[model samples]
Target: MNVQPPEAYATYKTYSAQLLAWDSSFSAFMSLKSHALTALQIRGAALLKIHHTTATIMGRCVPDPTDPRSIVTAANDPLIFSQSTNDFQTVVSLSQSLVAAAEQDIQRGNGRLAGGLTFSTDMGVVAPLYYVCIKCTDVPLREQAIELLGRCPRREGMWDSVLGVRMIREFWGMEEVHRQLRQGMVKLVLEDDGRWEWSWRDLHNGGEGGGVGYGVKEMLESQI
Candidate 1:
């Protein structure tokens, strides 16, 4: 839990590589224990591999504080954003696979639980899907992830998928407003005391007017 960033990155990378090797060996091993293992178990292994892959990609976003050469901040780091987008794509695929496998189990009456609620002490899909919603550059992929979250009424320890969906939706709205502000479709007004307020440009009204809003600075700062 107290691992240094570099060590954590290396550990995640090792986990990803080892999972790949294990996957390659699974066919031969399954031949001997095909009856012993269920399809869900196989899919679970794949889900674990996806988690490791996600961690490895996330690790790349952490800059080493001790390295002077690692001076590029995340705000301007193209590599970090690119890796995040890749992570989103990978997570979405694995999530779909896992959902399909679970649905199959339900149809065959192998599903363990009943009703719309599920509880698990272990970490589950919510966190990664939430990450995709916030970090992924692709709007459609982010929306897809949110849609997936909405389908599951579950709790993985402290994570609530329903709450996550609400938060992501709010985040999307905020991001759209920020985009509009950047494009000058919305305008921010600086008060005399250095506080920032915002208003719509009122393009239809033919005047630089709208109801003034407070906390614009706070909203912009949160994004930073």
Candidate 2:
């Protein structure tokens, strides 16, 4: 449930209906819904996963000034899995902070790290979506988000990542982006190049300077 603290979850649950209320106003505005994953949602999720991973990695490593140990290590130190009183709190806090950092890093030019507008080194890079677009601006994304705000035809249908990829290709004319999302497509340039999923995983693991994607080096060179 997004790694929130126990209390936060309880509090969040109190307003659960309000938190995700999709009434007539929403449905009226979102009449053009598709059964497939929209381009924005698909790319957004993939990028979100990357950003979440980055936040978790960075947040855990943000040494507690009061304590010498890192959060993850500290969490593991107290007990097998946070049986200690303060251990769990620290873990939960760091997780929440990382998530916030990731969101700020993406939606705005957060100064805490290499913001959306900056080309931070791999180690300092937080979110890849900002870096991926190279042309990402706040206004367009905000509008896009508001436009896509609606329940999918079904929850499980959202897993098909190719929908948004196709949309990206069709609307934005991003052929390579579509190719990357559709892992099964054979590489036009390399005979031995298998599915994009393997290459993407390799790129993801390599972290920064693994530069080279869709004929654009800057697009995919993220810190994490």
Candidate 3:
């Protein structure tokens, strides 16, 4: 995808600030009422997560002076990197809180809504937890997200916790293989250019533009 224009960055910053302001106002309102609504809290945290994740990605963009949308590169600025890390930390915390809140809600529901068969049109905890499971760099936090996904098997819109957990565990296995390759624990045949060609054939075998065909549970078990 092409890089966003300079104006896009400015717009993003404005939106982020507005989101923060709204969250602060909501918090103050809740404090005054001496009660916190779980649904509203979840919605607020999810919105912040979306904004922060976008900010983290945008922080890596270094737009070209001549054509802002045509050229981009990873930023080398320490402050930008710090801000990205802080944003990611916020995502992690929000994901954890969402999972805890969902678990409590499930408990209070008395097992009526704990299974994968339960469905909801409104946004729920599954997507946020899945996002953290796939995006967070912190191992423990990712594991916690995955574990929660496995335990709570509800369906939120099109998001299924069971399938999400499977995908996340598959992702974990892929990350593990990449880490081993980087550490030289995996043998590799390098080309003349000293680059190893990694193929996705083993992961997906429905020919070009095909979805993953293997079962995630089987893949993870083989890794074990």
Candidate 4:
């Protein structure tokens, strides 16, 4: 339960460049790496409903003196469970470790460019943004995520605004919320394409983690 200095963010772009320049191919070595990546993904999703705090997760959870390897309930609050003896810290550390490993990919090198947020170079790239925002209470990490994204006009998409409206409608199943979504909210930001727009960062990233677009539907439909 002692605090240690956090590991420095490691994305050695230079070393990655060197590795790629080598003439001898490492395709045989890469097969194991590929398998590991797939395994990690399988393992990650195995944790049920990580978006909700009370959900049970599958990972290196807290060590209990009573039951060292037994399944223990981890509270939903990542900030609370992040204490040294809890599961949140272990999960966060493992996530950062993945980022460190992906930093070694010289080809494309997008993982390194993703600012220690992603492992593979794809849609999952934005996962680190969701992680630090939820797990760690570090302001710098959140800033780093936004900075790495850079500035873009209309950064958040129409999907989010509609989802927000849907959320309001779902909650309490109130007629007022339905009226607002139909009249106030939707009319406030209708574009030429007849779609509502949003400019907020999506904390619950359904697109990357969830199977469908933004996973808002899934989250809503979930028993949580």
lDDT of each: 0.68, 0.34, 0.58, 0.34
Name model 2 segments beyond 4 Å from true: 1-35, 64-224
Ranking by TM-score: 1, 3, 4, 2
What's the lDDT of the predicted structure labeled candidate 3? Answer: 0.58
User: lDDT (0-100) at residue 1 of candidate 1?
Assistant: 22
User: Which stretches of model 1 miss by more than 4 angstroms?
Assistant: 1-37, 64-79, 104-109, 113-117, 189-197, 202-224
Model 4's alpha-carbon lDDT is: 0.34
TM-score of 1: 0.66
lDDT of candidate 3 over 58-154, digit per residue (tens): 5354543454333433343334444454555566566556556556766677334333237877665677667667655566767766776776677
Alpha-carbon deviation at 159 in model 3, angstroms: 1.1
Can you write out model 4's per-residue Cα lDDT over 1-224, one digit (the tens) per residue?
32222331122334344444431244444445546656445334322112222222212233333432333333233434344223333344444443444445433565434323322323332333344434444545544433333321111322122233334335424433444445433112335555543222233543322222221221112221
Best by TM-score: 1
Q: How high is the lDDT of residue 14 in model 1?
A: 82
Off by over 4 Å in 3: 1-3, 36-117, 189-224
Q: How far off is residue 105 in model 1, in Å?
A: 3.8
